[model samples]
Target chain A: MLRIEHFTKTYRSKVAVDDLTLHIAPGEICGFIGHNGAGKTTTLKACCGILQFDKGAITVNGHSILTDPIACKRDLAYIPDNPDLYEFLTGIQYLNFVADIYEVSKTDRNQRIAHYGNLLGMTEDLTLKISECSHGMKQKIALIAALIHKPRLILMDEPFVGLDPIASHQLKNVMAQHCAEGGAILFSTHVLEVAEKLCHKIAIIKGGKLVASGTMEDVRGQASLEQVFLDLEDTL
Target chain B: MIRTLVSLRFRALFTGLIVQRQKKNKSSKGTVILFAFLFLYVFAVVAGMMGFTFYSLAQPYHMLGLDWLYFSMAGLMGLGFAVLGSVFTTQNQLYDAKDNPLLLSMPIPPRIILLSRMIPLLAMNLLFGGLVIVPATVVYAIFVEFSIVGLLLQLLCLAGIAVLAQAISCLLGWLLHLLLSKLNKSLASVLYLVVFLGIYFYVYSQAGEILTAIVMESQQIASILSKWVWPLYAMGMGCLENGGLLLAFLGICAVCFAAVYAILSATFLRSATMSSVSRKRQKLNLKTSKTAPPVNAIVGKELRKFLGSPVYLTNLGVGLLMAAALTVAGVIFREDLLSAFSMIPGFTDLIPLLICAVLSFLISTMYISAPSVSLEGKNIWILKSLPVSGKDILNAKLLFHCRMTVPLCGICGFVLALAYG
Candidate 1:
């Protein structure tokens, strides 16, 4: 489970993310939606312990992101919008480094790497330096590296931007599977259709404030997710 | 549109410098005062050089006047050129590339982008050149009683020489890059080190001749160079005697500048467009094996990362190679060093161990394994998203640093002990 309360982030005189509160239960997929500069990324980063928030609390599995970041991070995985891995390392080498850090046993690491490598169609690219990989390839490697450790909670910011349709379908399946197996996912995306189709719960933010949060039916009140989004945006 | 773009870029560059200074908690007021002091120091250096030249010229056949002038000019020009090249090649690349992805993706033209970058390069070179050349020429003028025309001609000539030197250095660096890229990446790095060392040694050897001439016969030094050196002579004589050579020198500089600019611009564009290609791997026939030990895994990962990038590997990891070369050279060239050490009653046995420890520390810190986490650029998020604890990640990075440095340190220690014992 993940919880955030009264979170605020300010840069100079501007509030990038105002007081916000939300929660996600285990085995739930929450789609976070907002326009450009709506603070989706900021909130995700804050939750992941990447960026510090001015006032509020965020906890991953009862561990505070700030007070116990290492423990919190140990239970969570975060993938940023752009997947910039060490360009010098081959995909496999990078994975191995991640495995070493997570202390994943040799047997587990090999099994997981092989499973994910095959799923992502990255088995062939594992030997090649990341510098030689294309944008999508880098993203896949990043995704594989993130999931290899199998944390309780996963936080992804703009995770689907560079993925092709086939890759996207596979990722959606994996996300759903993860949720089914009792892990929660919090992802930010502009694609309302994907949010409608995949998210078990959805949260909408406008001007850094949480405008709506609940099950799609609860927030929409008989309207489609798109209509609900447009209506809320119109009211704003 | 171009003008707007250029001005915006220029403003951004200055703004960035200011922002960085602010971030570091440095006052803009302090920077201005520092620059003012630098200018004053430069002026004093130039005045002293000129006075020295005049004193030397006044004593004898006035033949030394030209020699002094040439020596000062070359020294000033060389120093200016070196500062410009170093700032442009290393400092600019290191800082600018930190935020280059954002800038590169913007709508600015490539040439304009290059020009905006070159502004700082030009400013630094011009500042250094003025400090050196102005004083040397002023003193020469006072001693020689140069007419206004002569002074103007000399100024023009110095300008050309400075530009020519800067252009040549930049061109040579570009050409070297192109040549190096044709070879295997690893071999190219080694070749670069060899070339760099070769040039440094050659330049060091010529230092004595240059300095002695400057101190002994300032005017004669200038005059000899003016007479024997085609461009400098043309420039100095034209200044001293109102001749046409100043225009000729300017013309040569202009042509050379244009050619060098064209070559560099083309090369820069090509490099920006070309994707880096990696070596293809052959399939391994070996069976799957168990994972290596924790330390070995960490060390292997770090070594792979270090070796994968030619630039980082050569610059950072080559400390061992450098230490080896230095040790061998010291043994070959300075047998007295070892003998002198042996005379220190209790210190003889400790020297090798001390050397090893120092080298290990230097190597470990210099390569910086922990900072590599931040250097991941965009990929840091992936690492952050893993289920690994921050301590584990930090430990892995630190382990890599120790792994590289400790063994090399041990080897060096062992070798030195064997030799001394």
Candidate 2:
């Protein structure tokens, strides 16, 4: 569902993501594991057409993010780690704004918002101005808005940081349900346990390079995902 | 810690001129100089008006043996100018600052925090006050007397008046904060526009007679000042080497300032942390959900933003207001303007061109689209991540701008055309 081919992004002189390649098929959750400053965000932003890359291409459902951004973006949703959504809008207003952009039918958007908003326990809070919401509430709103259009691919960066344990479990279930419906998710996270338990394929990155990537058993071999991540980090 | 806070506040004020907040590199030397000249130009124009007004008053008051009254008048005008200039800023800095909660959470005392914020405002008051007082002193020296001690005393009195101005502004700003929280912010901006335009038109119409009138009525004005406002009387006298009255005027200013500061300090934390009036809650109903075209949605968003933000509305909407005002003014003075145009050799034939030129000037001031991206600030990601093209977004903003401005211009053009014809 998402293919990042030889993607190299640079900031002035320093390289952010260097000659990296990764692919996530439909019905898969690809956990992109990296430490701080490991170019995880750089790669994620490039894939979502939020950042321009210096080399190579990122494609979503066969549409190039650089050349066919609107088409690529129509098939995917990106929820950044901080959930910096529009504070001037009420939660439902923001959802409707996004829905309007994707041309989501009034009926479909209403049903999806209700379904996701209830699953995240955010139904009562949707009437409040986003500025008045807590960090966790904003995250839930972003999640609901992302799912409102029924995008085929989801690109999330640290999507669980501010969520309560119940919401986090619910989000895990949502991810599983999305993959079960043949939609793929490529998310970056530091929580190895969540990645180990949830991800069908795991890609470990160290210093802008893909250190190991494959099915869970193939990458971890008899060890845990945390050990493999730490071993990769120690070598750097 | 106070020094650090004050420096940060100053940096915040000069961020765009000295260095953009989004950029890491310093502003180019040319950009800095250009900004300096632009600011200086505005300051010079206002100061020049003050200088001229005082110049007109100086010799008349001196000949009438009302030198003390001359100084008192300048002090009063200076106080009014400074208070009006700084009141909105004081309200915003005190009540609406984004970092208030962050700083309030720190270990610093609330009073100290308030002091640091007020110190910059005091500096601004001094600058605004000086725009009037400095020009008055220079005219006074040129036309009346230039005694070294007297000049220094006038300056000292000016400092006291600036403190008084700051106190007045704080009180008024507090009132505005409370009032604005309850009312639509656009109303205050509209009031500001009306007052500004009212003064402008009155002066414009009476350009020849007003200064002469002030000169003619100098005695009555002087008497009113002396009998009703004794502090101003003392301020005037003190400016001319009356050390005792200077001390008295200074004392009154100091007392007023201290009382205001004490009262504000007691409630600084409470007011600073106060959120806007809480809105009544309403749960979302999916049954009532609706959608619009993407372009229309973007324009609706822009409209809401323009209305919600006072700065955005006033600065940009002034053009639309002017266009409306011109249409009304043109209708009212249609016969007079047509006669005036006939007096010009070729102007009658060029009426449409002239009207077009005037309306174009007004419409140019409507900035419905230009600042949209920059105004997004941290929310650029929402647009960047969305399925809409950048071109589509900008086109929507332009469409919104056109909808706001073009119809008004067309109506203005049509009405003036008919009225003139």
lDDT of each: 0.70, 0.89
Model 1 regions lying over 4 Å from their true place: A5-19, A54-56, B5-9, B21-132, B138-151, B180-198, B201-206, B213-229, B261-272, B277-322, B336-401, B404-421
The digit string of per-residue lDDT tens for model 2 on A120-209 reads: 999889998887798999999999989988889999999999999999999999999999999999999988899999999998887888
Off by over 4 Å in 2: B200-208, B339-347
DockQ of each: 0.46, 0.73
Interface RMSD of each: 3.6, 1.5
Which structure among the candidates has the greatest lDDT?
Answer: 2
lDDT of 2 by residue, B1-421 (tens): 9999999989889884687766567899998999899999999998998998899889988999899988998999899989989999999998888899999999999888888888899899999999999999999997888888988998998899999999999989888888887776777877876797788789878966977877888888888888999999999999988999999999999999999999889988988877674654686787887789999999888887787677888889889988998999999998898888889898898988888889878877887789988998878888999989999999999998999998999998889989986
The weakest ten consecutive residues by lDDT in model 2 chain A span A83-92
Clashing pairs in 2: none
lDDT of 1 by residue, A53-159 (tens): 89999999899988888788778888788877877677787777777667777778788878887787877778877877888888898888788778889999888
TM-score of model 1 vs. true structure: 0.78
